[model samples]
Target: MNAVEIQTHARKLYDAHGTKALAEAAQMVRELEQRGEKKLVEDWRRIQSALQQMRGPNVS
Candidate 1:
């Protein structure tokens, strides 16, 4: 997905799942990597990064 599409999907995910969306994205990344889905893994990593940016830095 393009940057815009990634951001849009990230926003939708955040809206639907809140902070849990980050975990969901991370899970997807891991699964994709294990499946050898390089392209999808890259996209999901982008989604995960976007989620982190949306959630801001970890406090603890």
Candidate 2:
């Protein structure tokens, strides 16, 4: 597929599963935090923020 088509399909998949992926990642962050992995938690939060931004401005 062309670049545009690939990007289109990727966005479609992300739109369908982005929230679920974020939730699962957040859960992992929580578990790590509970175990006192503060550094990892911060790293994961950065990843989560990037994903949220990609979802758009209106997202929480």
Give residue 1's lDDT in candidate 1 (0 to 100): 100
TM-score of each: 0.89, 0.62
Best by lDDT: 1
> Once superposed on the true structure, which residue ranges of model 2 sit more than 4 Å away at CA?
1-17
What lDDT tens digits, residue by residue, belong to model 1 across residues 1-60? 999999999999999998799998999899999999999999999999988888897798
Candidate 1 deviant stretches above 4 angstroms:
none
Residues 1-60, candidate 2, lDDT per residue (tens digit)? 444543454455457776685776578689999999987777666666656656677835
Model 1 weakest lDDT span, ten residues long = 51-60
Indicate which candidate wins on TM-score.
Answer: 1
lDDT of 1 at 49: 90
